[model samples]
Target: MTLVVFLLVPRLHLLDLAGPAQAFSTAADLGHGYELRYVAEHEEVPTAQGVPLRASVQWPALTADDLVIVPGWRGRFAAHARLSKATRAALVAHHASGGTVASVCAGAYALAQAGLLDGRRSTTHHALQDELAARYPATRVQRDVLYVVDDRVVTSAGIASGIDLALHLIAVRHGAADAAKVAREMVVYARRNGDEPQRSAMLRHRGHLSDTVHRAQDLIDARFADRLPLAEIAAACDVSPRTLTRLFSAATGMTPLRYQQTLRLERAENLIAHGSTVDAAARSTGFDDARMLRRLRSRLP
Candidate 1:
């Protein structure tokens, strides 16, 4: 396989760079025909922590290939935006020509900026979930699974989720058993599909929302069982109820009530599945009524 990865300068995490690089290299060592190339916006790229990276090729030099990996950018995503216009255009063109595009963590931001994620499901670091959805309303940002493969595009959650995703791709291209051997060599257990929640249970902050609104969300999360109204939350943020509803919905896909319900139900499901009873799980997740919880769960399925 021939592959070229585009790393954002001044923000590429070492692991994101090394994970796929090592995966393909090991595949080659294991008798698979694989070639990997790492490119960047400039000839000499530097990480967010100032570790200099020697790019194999610059942006202008990159051309179409079998696969292109975009590593997460470093620093605050809003502060450190995605690729330059030319680079973004090139990526769009490359994907349009039938190439696979994969992103780890903040790398999804670049893909979203290029409009590649529109109407597709993707993921990133759980902490940036709200920001991602706010920026790309057309994109369905999933947080509960390790990675989601939407056609030719694949996206993983923050950090080590990249490893899981990389191994998955390797398994798909080569074989699961071969990928398992590689993962064992790397000291990571071979994980199967849907092995873990892709998204964190914690809510993310939207940069555009006020600090007060952010605090309000934290409060609601902490006390999900409390019947807090939108008016109460808005008052806490010194905003009108309508304003609060709009901002919260914009930050997250659902309204405040829906977001709270989703979180509560997620917690309830986790608690109910094992040794615990349904009532116990419901109570643990702040639902006083087990019937209500079961109704909600039934609706979801």
Candidate 2:
């Protein structure tokens, strides 16, 4: 398949372009056929980092291919963010002809602007979640997911998550084995499926809480794998178990046990993703016993 990626200049994140390009390049190197091209509004354009690249085709001259990608944009937080009309029209025409459209991070903003995201559930960098929802009210913005594939439109969270998204596309478009090979060359795990909840620290929503509670929560986070019990946590907070429970619940909107479980689960998922065996993951997350971790995961989803 041919992959024509539109990398808008002065606003595209490097890895958002590199990750998918590397995946597809690896695919072609392994004897599969793939035509890859980096395109822009003009032949030569500068990236956010001031690196200039000459694209194979200009935006106005781009013809449809198997896939069209809009990598994460630079100047994403600007008040008057918008894509050029030509680029928007090209994307609309490409998608209308049944081509796949994908975006990494704030690249979804371009798709949302093009009216392609209408009624589709998607995600971007967590900071932009509210902006996406406000601008494209027709779209359902998913804040906690790593990525979403609504029909042919694939949207992913943040920069590194773009790699995960591309790996998924490679797996689905080619096969699992091909995607695995690409991951091996990149020294990363196989792409996580879209339904996985995002584990990025940047995604958490903050809240107002007492200084004591915040301090207690910080200590808990720092010592998450210490196998600290409820009584220990309460004592650390200089409070009784009953008082600690009430305070923790009021501040975080979850029970202390639930919050700890969430932390453990997020750590376990990270370990699993980083190539740890399930047993190792359980052990690292303070689940010394295999069956205990299995039971916990079974309750998750």
Local accuracy by lDDT, each model: 0.70, 0.70
Q: Candidate 1's residue-wise lDDT over 170-262, tens digit each?
A: 655543446655664675643433436533333222333455555556666656667888888888778898988887777655677876777
* TM values, all candidates: 0.61, 0.61
Q: For candidate 2, lDDT tens digit of each residue in 1-301? A: 5765655655477887887878778888987777786777667766677677778556433344477888886654453246689778878888888777889888888888888999898899988889888888999998767788786788988887887777667655543445555665786643343445543221131244466565566556556567778888888889988888888778667766666666666667656644678899788777768787788878866
TM-score of 1: 0.61
Q: Tell me how far the alpha carbon of residue 50 in candidate 1 is from the true structure, in angstroms, after superposition.
A: 3.4
- 299 Cα displacement, candidate 2 (Å): 12
Per candidate, the number of residue pairs that clash is: 5, 1
Q: Lowest lDDT 10-mer window, candidate 2?
A: 199-208
Cα RMSD to the true fold for all candidates: 16.5, 12.3
